[model samples]
Target: MNVLVTGATGTVGAHVVDGLRYAPDAAVTAASRDPVTARERLDCATVGFDFTDPTTYRDAFAEIDALLLVRPPALSRVRRDIIPALSAAVGAGVEFVVFLSVIGADRNPLVPHARIESWIADSGLETTFLRASFFMQNLSTTHREEIRDGRLAVPAGDGKTSFVDARDVADVAVRALREGITGAYDLTGPDALSYAEVCAVLSATLEREVEYTDPSLPRFLVSRYRLEGDLAKAGVMAAIYTTARLGLAARVTDDVRSLLGRPPTDFRAFVRDNRTVWT
Candidate 1:
């Protein structure tokens, strides 16, 4: 089966490539806008495919059997960038698609994932929707500096989240692509933890007294995210915090362990394995 994985250089997509490369029956193609640069970055075969460009969609989808579809966070124009590409791929007879959706997307109409999901259902293309939870990687990337400084600052209001590992999501995605599983599945870590609990875990792992601070909007926007005076970006950040605060992301599911037949990597292991990043 020829599998085309979009967003191939991203954290989850790259792991999908890594997992599928070992599948004897699956031929993996990493999709990117620039094949030359993509080829240099990815170990697998590369094709120049951009979500914003319909012209690039056909050639990349041609003769492709399966696809791991993910809407890049920055691409909010779902009807424009996503649907057209999906329509082209389906028209080209691509058999199945494994869509990387998010937790509570079905209920949250403001986000693009739900709209994309609705479009896919209406498209009648065989599909599997992986509604993955908050990524544990947020610590290592988006919220790392605070951890290093022994403080966890956010306006999440003590709501909990079941953060899944991106690698685990990728593993499930590869299985869906290869096995041709079609349905909506929730992939999450074993535990749902509040930011304070999260700090406790990190403190235990790092042997430091990390504290949690529910910072005000100005402090978080200007100091934490460093997007001062950028209302658009700040608004997006606020929406994300609202999602967490409303407890929309706190559900823990065994989908990863059920699919992989192995336990999902917990937050402690994640913090331990990526210890150097915090220090």
Candidate 2:
């Protein structure tokens, strides 16, 4: 099977690329905005792909059997940018699609994932939706600086989040691509943990005290705005945390284990493996 993985260098996409390397029957191509850099980094077949650029779609989807659709976080306008790309993929004769969506996206029409899911269903292509929970890697990538400084600041209140490792999510995506699995699966870690509990895990693993500030929504918005300097991006992040605060992100499931034939990686194991980032 030939597969194209969008956002190839991103959190979960990068891991997808790595996992596909071992799949003997699957030929994987990494899609990036910069194919030259992606080729150099991933050392695999790379294609230049941009969601807003229709011209790149044909070449990116050419001769592809399945697609791993991942939305770049920067692009928010789904109607203008994403829908066209999905349409192009269909036109190009792509057979199956595995969309990396978020948990609670089906019920929450406010998030872009919901609209994308709806469009894919109507597009008549075979597809699977991996509605993943909050990623544990968020601490290592998005909030790395805060963790380095020994503070975990977010607007998630005291709500627990079922955090899945990106590697686990990627493993499932690879399986879906190779086996032609179709349906919606809610992928999550073994436990739901609040930021306070997360901090404790970090402290024990890293041998340093990590504190959860439990900042309010307004404060988080201002802080994110200052950090990213983009109000729209900040607003999107605030909404995710708000979902957690409302106790909507804590649902755990056996989907990961069922699909992978193994228990999902726990938060403490993730911290132990990636402890260097915080140090």
Candidate 3:
């Protein structure tokens, strides 16, 4: 089966590539905006693809059978980018889609994942929604600087989130693509923990004290904007944290075990395995 994996450079997508490496059925194509650089980095067949650009879809989806769609967090305009890409995929005769959506995306309209998930369902193509929880890799990427400084800043209020590892998400994606499973699967870690609890785990795992900074939205937005120089993106990010702060993203699910036939990786195990990144 020909599979096009979007966001090829990302944590989840990279692992998807790794999982499919041994899958005899999947001829995986890693799709990124810069196919030349992607080829060098991913060491796989690469194609130039962008959700925002309709023209890139034609060649990228050429003879493609299934899609592993990962919306880069920067792209927020679902109506403009996502729907058009799905339309293009349909036109390209792409039959199956395994979309990586966020946990509670169906109910939470604050983010673009919900809208994108809706569009995939309404597209009449066979679809499988991988409703993933907060990624455990956030410690190494988004919150790395904060974690390095001994504090993880966010506006999670009193909420708890099940932080699933990207590897598990990718493994599930590989299976769903190969088996062509339809409907939705909520991928989450075994335990649901608040930010404070997460920090405790980090402290224990890293053997150093880590604190949780529950900053206000405005402060987070301004700080992130100053750091990233993108107000719109920062605001969108703030809204995502705000939604989690409202206790909307705290649910834990057994879909990972059900999909993989084994228990998903837990927080302490993730931190222990990735300890070098923090140090």
Once all C-alphas are superposed, what RMSD does model 3 give against the true structure?
A: 1.3
Model 1: per-residue lDDT, tens digit, 49-112? 9988877987899899898997876677688868889989998988788999888888777667
Off by over 4 Å in 2: none
Candidates in order, TM-scores: namely 0.91, 0.96, 0.96
Candidate 1: TM-score?
A: 0.91
Candidate 1, residue 62: CA error in Å?
A: 1.3
How much does candidate 3 score in TM-score? Answer: 0.96
Residues 156-258 of candidate 3 have per-residue lDDT tens digits of: 8878888899899998999999998888988999988899999998899888999998988889988998888987688777776776788877888889998
Residue 208 CA displacement from its true place in model 2, Å: 2.6
**lDDT for position 16 in model 1:** 92
In model 3, the clashing pairs are none
Report the lDDT of model 2 for residue 82: 96
- C-alpha lDDT of all candidate models, in order: 0.86, 0.91, 0.87
Residue-level lDDT tens digits of model 2 in 1-279: 889999899988988999897789899999999999999999899999999999899899999989999998877779998999999999999989999999988877767888899999998999999999999999899999989999989999998999999889999998998899999999999999998999999999989899999788899999988988987778777778887888889999999999999999999999999999989
